[model samples]
Target: MLSASEASIEAELKTKGLNAPRLTPADIDAAIVGEDFHVFPGTTMTVCALKLRNGFVVIGESAAASPENFDASIGRRIARDNARNRIWELEGYRLRSLLAANA
Candidate 1:
């Protein structure tokens, strides 16, 4: 069952006509900047790179920090969300073009 947040996200994607291809951890290359508890006191930054089947590459970066410690996954999730938002923006243009054609 999809959680409320998941359902909402799905609906938003569908409404925007943004369909993202499946991406696995292996398909994404991640780079972490600022060592946890070393370089950055309590923050971690991650940059994720994904190569699309269309021969285009998209990169996203995010920084996250917790009160007690730094969570690497948090940064990764933020970066992934950033990349998805970029994809949505690109897809929006395509949707506009399609609408213009059909009109």
Candidate 2:
């Protein structure tokens, strides 16, 4: 969950035409996992990749373990954030190219 301030920042960014992808807890929970998409665990980090139906692959990674934060939930959130960031970047590029072509 985003704090009030964080949500406001995100809203401001979006209003400025920034490409931002927001994923709720429910969205993360409902994320599909199979041969095409899955989380890969490493010794120091966890990497997750989702293969979209449209053949786009979004990847994310997070620290596997932290001394100060032992909760797995934090890592999961980080991974999801990373994934969404990648998605936003790709979408932004696509949109730019599309607008350029239309112009």
Candidate 3:
């Protein structure tokens, strides 16, 4: 399910007549075959590596200003989000290329 903001954007898109193929959440999940995360030793830095189905890897990082203020959960979440953001662009490009080819 899309978040409220996303839903709103989707609705607006429909109103403006943008019915072209889009990169949905399911597409992102389907593209990702494996995921791994790491938190650096003695630091608040976290990194997430997402492996796509085509063997490409996308990496994302998160870091807290002070180790004392860092939470592993938050760091991992943020890092994963950053990684996922990259997938959107990659997948979008793939979709566009396929569309152009078929045009």
Candidate 4:
């Protein structure tokens, strides 16, 4: 797996991504500046917060109906993935807006 800051990855992404006329994984990845996670006390609830470059925050949640099924690692990953999915929609809209403005 390539780290996000690698020049080769960024170069390739910029070259191919700009002309695609749609949101790309690189685009979404680029927008994320920070991530935070939390679990509610005495509950099987997990929360993930993604901080974007523009200072906007998106949140995602995961909960287990039963304590027996709750796993810390799994819950955190699920919550983070849920938050990551929202970034796609937000980035898609941003891409669309940019496209519209340039048209």
Best by TM-score: 3
TM-score of each: 0.54, 0.58, 0.84, 0.78
Tens-digit lDDT string for candidate 1 (24-77):
222232212222212244447677665555556566777655545556676676
Q: Residue 2 in model 4: shift from native, Å? A: 9.8
Cα deviation at 36, candidate 3, in Å, is 0.5
In terms of lDDT, model 3 sits at 0.88
lDDT tens readout by residue for model 2, 11-69 = 78768987634443334334434212234443446566766545666778787455465
Summarize candidate 4's per-residue lDDT along 9-62 as a digit string, tens digits.
557877876556766566777888999999999999999999999999999899
Report the Cα lDDT for residue 82, model 3.
Answer: 90
Give the poorly placed runs of model 4, Cα more than 4 Å off: 1-19
Clashing pairs in 4: none
Highest-scoring model, lDDT:
3
Ranking by TM-score: 3, 4, 2, 1
Question: Which has the higher lDDT value, candidate number 2 or candidate number 4?
Answer: 4
Q: What does candidate 3's lDDT look like per residue over 21-81, in tens digits? A: 8877767878889989999898888999999999999999999998788999999889988
Deviating ranges (above 4 Å) for candidate 2: 1-44, 64-68
Error at 29, model 1, angstroms: 17
Model 3 bad stretches (over 4 Å): 1-4, 11-17
